[model samples]
Target chain A: MTSETPAALAKAAERPRPALSMSTGRAGDRIFAGLSRGSGLVILAIMAAIAVFLVWKAIPALQDDKANFLTSQEWNPDGAPAKFGIAQLVFGTLMTSVLALVMAVPVAVGIALFITYYAPRRLAGVMAYLVDLLAAVPSIVYGLWGLNFLVTKMTGVSGFLNSYFGWIPLFGGSETGGRTILTAAIVLAIMILPIISAITREVFVQVPHAHVEAALALGATRWEMIRMSVLPFGRSGMVSAAMLGLGRALGETIAVAMVLSTTAGIDWHILKDGGNTFAANIANTFAMSGPTGRSALIASGLVLFVITLLVNVGARAVVARRKEFS
Target chain B: MAKRIEVSGLHAYYGGTHAIEDISMTIEPRSVTAFIGPSGCGKSTFLRTLNRMHEVIPGARVEGKVMLDDEDLYDSSVDPVAVRRVVGMVFQRPNPFPTMSIYDNVAAGLKLNGVRGKRRLDEIVEESLRGANLWNEVKDRLGKPGAGLSGGQQQRLCIARAIAVQPQVLLMDEPCSALDPISTLAIEDLIGKLKSQYTIVIVTHNMQQAARVSDRTAFFNIAGTGKPGKLIEIDDTSKIFTNPEQKGTEDYITGRFG
Candidate 1:
């Protein structure tokens, strides 16, 4: 009987089963797949349309402007010559966003680690919810709070830094007004904190138990474990989170405009109270200007759009470069 | 430099659930001891309690007296990190720090112990790979990521990493359960050679494997679901297989019952 069972089992194994061909996908399945693909293409089409419209509107402003658009610092689109440039606006946008990222990333990562590794289980949930609440606050509300409360409160601190560190180029100028680029960057930093921390917290939580145990088994202390296993594994994640925060800081309109009192030119020192980003400039001037002035604002908006795109693409390239081991 | 271990009145718990109860044994230096039990029988838990690795889980605690030569391992003053440095571990599935190269994986523990010179690290990394019997296949490619190795080679790399620090005791929790038969035989052979240098304690489910590699065998069993695991018998491998003192051990060995 055992011999017969072996022979029968061999015969059964040798028999071919039915082939699973593409014909198995019914018409309904194909239709659903097509719908998903169509949706993705539609999003691309919308993005292309917006790009085309921005470029169309920006060309007339470039033709009318007498000043060099790339190098000139003055923006007087309402004048007969319609002189304008993006140099100062570019500097303001990059400086404010970069400064905010420098201040926010370290604190965000610290808060994320504390919530993930150190806090008690019940308290961690509460802390995470509080961070989410920070993200939920309206930008207008933050603008009001920054303009009324934080700028006034920061006057003493700004004056103190200018006095002690004035020899440093970035902190060189005297602080005549409290509403400066420094205060605007502080407000932007506070705005982006929740997003970076929330994303970083999720990334830290996803570190594998096996890797953690591997570090612990190697006799690593708690801080050493974080440095060895947690940080390296979450490097790309933290970078992406920081990039997302940067994207927000770059395009924030009401908050930067409400806090920063713009002057005519760019200053090397951030404590001197005069800077204007593309988003804030458009919001502050678009409604009251003539057609050429409005087109100039759109031209600046186009520049901001391109800068953000380059930043995101650069971040992706960085992530791709480090993908070999991960 | 292996040291003997004496464990008495060891009780382990997860939250309020008692996992192992009243376990007592003396593990000899420079020998292989095997822990065999069914699933959920707490053999793995008992193995973890030896090196204090079990307490990493939240709410997991132990009440015990574990002496390494003269010092109590469970004393409040004895740092768990320090204990782990003295007692190394190899896990069931090979984990070789996915982001590190093969050389870095082996040298990681040594570096943590403050060995900084390049020449010394090179000497120790080569020595450890040779000890794990993985030198010939991987010496030319030490710069490669550790995760790129085959399963058997990766497991050996983990062994090399664990022994790089030259700890006194080596704890393995089902080290061969994830390998094929040929890889299993290779690891079994390596264990035989390693017994001369390190005190080895291993938890396994395969009775034949335990009989082959271990000098002494410990059998654990539970009365019913949710009951704490208890040690049924511990004796020489030959005696445990041929003439057990307990009926529970006899039944488990003979495939009569778990």
Candidate 2:
């Protein structure tokens, strides 16, 4: 019986195995792989196409301009001798986005921490739902609200800052109306808050259960546990979230256009009226612009696109560097 | 600074579900007491209750009394954080803070207790790492992340982190269950060495492990699914393994049934 069993086992081992094939033998597998690879290439193609189009459309206005397209503060592209530059637009975009980031990141992180750690379970669920719902509110609606409600209410805030903090160069302007860069920045901050908090909350929630328990087991108070484990683990995530918020603020058009009374020059005094970002300028001028003006706006749009891309790439690099340690 | 543990008429629950019921035991100072049970027996839950870690889970609660050398651990005046400081825990899996260096991992608990000065932290971190039998392997790369270590090394690093706070008791909830055989042997040896200075309670599924390390052994069992687990018997390790007074303990020891 043993000899017969050994012969049968040897015969079984010699049989050709159909399951060992690793190739994509089935039609479904080949089609799915091809489709996924095609989708990835399509994204790359679309990105390149947009860049090519922007550069192609922008060159004519840039060549015809009398002033330096980069350094000149003038924005009269349709004149007999066209004049335009991105300096003022660049300054406004950076100032408002950076200001918004400074104002929003702390409050967003605070709200995230409170929802994840401090709130009761039911309240946390409700709060998280509300924050997500806030993100779904349309940008145009935010613009309308900023123009009618927020701008009117912000005069007192602008006055207070001018009264007490006017010594700081950024606040030294004499403008007392609500339609200043500060008001626009405040609206931008509010616009980006939901997204920043949502992402920060997800990062906080993804902090490993073991790490949290390790802190608590070591006798750490709740606050200490958060500081030691939660914050350090979520640091890179929070930075990326803030970077994403910055990207949104930089490109935000309608709200900034509605809030800020436009001017074509750089102003460090954020409390003063009159600043124009690339997106706001494009939105405000696109309808009235002649062909040269439209091309000029497209040129500025290209720069804004590049800046946002750089910001996102920088965020990815920061996240990747921290990934090694974690 | 080992302290005796006296648990009396203890019951634990998870929301509406009773987990462990009426477990009473005395664990001597400077010795190891092991809890041996099948899956779903609530042995881990009972061990967590010793340090108030059970209540950390939302809706989980405990009833009755646990005294650490005449001090009621569950007393309203006693903060759970303070209780945990005195009774440190090692989990089933290795959990060194992934963001921290090996040196910082060992110093973590000490930092929480407000220990300052670089020299002092360095001294204690080295001492604790040596105590966990991990100093030699990691001494040269102390600045490296703790998560970069092997599973066994990470577990020992967690042990070092726990003991750095100078706890009176150490509770291990199946500390070596996730480890390879070699790592398991190393942890068992470390557990044997640790019992000279800290009261230790270990929950293990391995019967031979229970026989090898424990001074006293406990047998826990449940009647059925959804039923609260109960302690079957507790006695000297030799007696429990050879001639248990309870029928269920004997059946479990002899592999008749869980």
Candidate 3:
């Protein structure tokens, strides 16, 4: 239609344009909706892309027969013919993660409870901040610190245990054995402690004041209120917090490798010698690997990916059940 | 049957802010007492003091004597938990431990006091729900979540949970404020029934509620900013509403000033 035609003129009226004076919803609201939809779509697309890429890269390793991607323990990517299995890597990974969680959960929950329930108000904020700072420290820094400082401390502790509980298979190793799975687990605990503790402290603080007051008014001691009101209210947070920390521990590489001094073998004694986690096995052996070795490493990585997926799924389930903090 | 709660020259503060000024009143056993005033007039604060709940807040402190049956509640040797076991509180909002079910909510108080035999717990839960007038509504659904109840029902559930231990006194802070008229009436009727067996203390912004439920009415008012609250007048509910001695109490009850 010609620019001056009635059809063109009506089309001009039909064109979308921003109205300055006439208003229904404020302009800010429309902009907010636009921003939210844009960001949401971007996150969705990114996550989908990552999942596709991970699955694509993982297929080759899974398909390899000698890789024993799911079952066997022999992870010799550098064997004469380059046949490898994930069995030992899986065992090592589970051992290290469970050990780390065993050490961290109680301490994390206790620290959180102490800060929220018992610490003097004037001091509690500063203590909470210090715990938060732990999470800010980089994973590499934790590795360095674990090697330089924590290893020696754990060595001393390992010595005492060797003397006392050495009869047990796990602790039978020489106390001087500095690099072992036990050491790696303790290092992992320190690394993830802040994550669990911070979430738990926040959860404890979010317990409704009225619930707390109701408990208190009923003649509950401070500890009783914590047991009755605070802990139960924060239970889901505590569980998810632990799962979040587990996610971190699952894929950690640099720190675990730095401290573990891992060897390629299947040994039930965690304190005897260093055993490699899947992430550490990949990081430690990737440079020296041939094609089969790399394939085997990729196979282990696939397993690590599955573990993290399961952990994150569990965390989401817990988060769904938890009440809002406010 | 005539237990007494005596508060004498009581003062309480949050940090440096005076929340409750010097106030004294005696509550009779099985009698309903209402603390009424404008918002921030220390009614809730004073109610908290009776149960030693004020101390639970960080920086909250109280001074002076709070005697129940002539025993000082704030005495250093007194156990706060023991004190709470005897006096229970219902909050402004219904909080039924969202994680727990209807059965568990009533049993919580008993469990806290170390009463754990299953038969005994079941008996107490049934009796408490009946006392709160909520047994019939939730009897079949004791396994359901307490949070899923209607507002009034949730509140009665909370009340049942509190009274499960058979406390000597009950403290309520605006127990009906969040409820509708029908729910409010139900709770009010429950309160009347409750006071015959347990001493009851309540705080409310609605003057008509104070008039309707309380056996004795206390009129409290703010004296000055940053100062403790003062008791303007306290007497029989009818006398306080119709023939108060203080002009401030009359002005307040008449809707001239709050």
Writing each residue's lDDT as its tens digit, candidate 3 over B1-258 gives: 336899999999998898888888889899999989888888889998888888877789999999999789999999877888888889999988877899998888888888989898889999999999999999999999888899999999999988888888899999999999999999999999998899999998888999999999998999766777888878999999999999999999898993
Q: Please identify model 1 stretches exceeding 4 Å from their true place.
A: A1-31, A317-326
Q: Which stretches of candidate 3 lie above 4 Å from their native place?
A: A1-67, A78-80, A152-156, A159-163, A166-176, A323-326, B224-226
Q: lDDT, candidate 2, residue B52?
A: 96
lDDT (Cα, tens digit) per residue for candidate 2, span B195-232: 99999999999999999999999999999999999999
Error of 1 at B255 (Å): 2.1
How many pairs collide in each candidate, listed in order?
0, 0, 7
Candidate with the larger TM-score of 1 and 3: 1
Candidate 2 has an lDDT of: 0.93
Model 2, position B39: C-alpha lDDT score:
93
Backbone clash tally (model 2): 0
Looking at candidate 1 chain A, the ten consecutive residues that score lowest on lDDT are A317-326
lDDT of 3 at A242: 95
Q: Clashing pairs in model 2?
A: none
Best by DockQ: 2
TM-score of structure candidate 2: 0.94
Candidate 3 iRMSD in angstroms: 1.4
Q: For candidate 1, lDDT tens digit of each residue in A1-326?
A: 86799899999999987677746658989899999999999999998998999999999999999999998999999899899999999999989999999999999999999998889889999999999999999999989999999888877777888888888888887554668888899999999999999989998999989888888998999888898789989898899889989999999999999999987778878887789999999999989999999999999999999988887887777668667755
